[model samples]
Target chain A: MEGEIRVGIGTDADLVIARAEGRAMAQRLGFRRPDPTLIATAISELARNLVMHVGHGEIIMRPIVEDRRSGVLVIVRDEGPGIADVGAALRLGHASRGGLGLGLPGARRLMDEFEIDSQPGKGTTVTMRKWRLRDDLERLREKRQQRG
Target chain B: MSVAILRKGEYFIASIQSDLSDTEVLALRDDLIERVGRFRALGIVVDVSALDVIDSFAARALRSIALAAKLRGARTVIVGIQPDVAVAIVQFRLNLDPLRTALDLDEALALLELRPERKPADGR
Candidate 1:
């Protein structure tokens, strides 16, 4: 929780904040080109989903580490009328709400891992992560730089 | 101002300065559409190099801007999409059909001047 950041998604302005923060965090975690941009785009989609449908939600971002790989984890949650059919929502080009219908599926394609949980009448929670691995030479260079 | 709109000759140029909110994005679209009709411009260029992320909503808004401007008898060319941003857009599989793009503002201006009659293939 030390490195976790939570942003309230109550308005369109909040989406801007979440996207910038996600991109910054990804860059700090050493995510290479395209990954940081991808993460930021994914954050935008999830935050927009809340603003469009539920009108309010929260996005949590934190650095993750596992098995010699470092990554960023993003969790978006909203307390509103949940999805009736998760499958339908994830299906590309199916605009359940007359929008582009690409938010969920597009975010899924941008990240390495994705999971969504929704209960009709309850709420929806989405968790996604993107990882980056440092190769041996890069690790050695980092060690050398640390020594100096 | 998040976006700057300038007039050069017969075209209107709207350059987005930074990341924009949904409301601002829509506002830019509406503003451009109205300007195209009011000015009776021949072409319009939208610069988005400052935007690091172009998600589905932004992407859709762009296409809408192009189509609406076209309806007003003005050609629209999008300029300055960063390389990383382009990659993310492709991965998202966002539909940007009918929206012409140029590497920069100069090319966009040239594109409008080159072919004034029919739609040309996408410019990278």
Candidate 2:
């Protein structure tokens, strides 16, 4: 329950490593078939955010327990110029910086718990905890489909 | 890159592979839409176990397929939800739950009275 993997890379947002990390980390937690799908999604979003928004950032993953269950805590931090619009960034269907608009908000939704902080000229930090099964997230995901 | 359909009595069961990227899904979308109209299967189950990841494009694509099937008078259900994939839906907060999901291929087929579809019956 105590393993930390740190990645410091220049951000070109290559997806292979992020995807592999997602698979390995999820498997270690005994996460089943489709859960890897979720983790891979979050991993890709965070890694892409690091590479794209932060330009150069780091990804640190650790294990944590939420609601009396095991889950992973993924912390993505970038020392780039930071975000000018934190509120706007989290809004659905809003991506202007080469992302699918799902990088931050998407990662937030995929995990069991989501939190983020950023400054316009400083940096950004995202923390996400994902479980083997989370209800709130699933509900939210389904809601949007209905709206659209 | 794969297709498996199970037939039980009258219902046709089909499960798609997860390796399908956005481009691949686009093609499948068209094929399935056509099949839905042609076959008149009572239901559909798409297996997403192979896809190690999901994004907005993928999420939207799934919805499109479901909509397409519904238009063809078929009720579509998605199957093979890996835990991580579920997490991605939650974390990325994508709009996928409306489509449908199952834990495995067998459960997926069982739910809709379907069997894995492999090929056309002797070219009919």
Candidate whose DockQ is highest = 1
CA lDDT of A91 in candidate 2? 85
Docking class of 1: high
* Displacement of the residue B92 alpha carbon in candidate 2, Å: 4.7
- What candidate 1 keeps of the native contacts, as a fraction, is 0.91
Candidate 1 on B18-82: residue-level lDDT in tens?
89999999999999999988888999999999999999999999999999898889999999999
The parts of candidate 2 lying over 4 Å away from their true place are A1-17, A25-39, A46-84, A93-102, A109-148, B2-14, B38-42, B52-56, B103-124
Fraction of true contacts kept, per model? Answer: 0.91, 0.64
Best by TM-score: 1
| Pairs of residues clashing in candidate 1 | none
Lowest-sum lDDT 10-residue window in model 1 chain A: A134-143
- What is the model-wide C-alpha lDDT for candidate 2? 0.69
| lDDT score, candidate 2, position B3 | 58
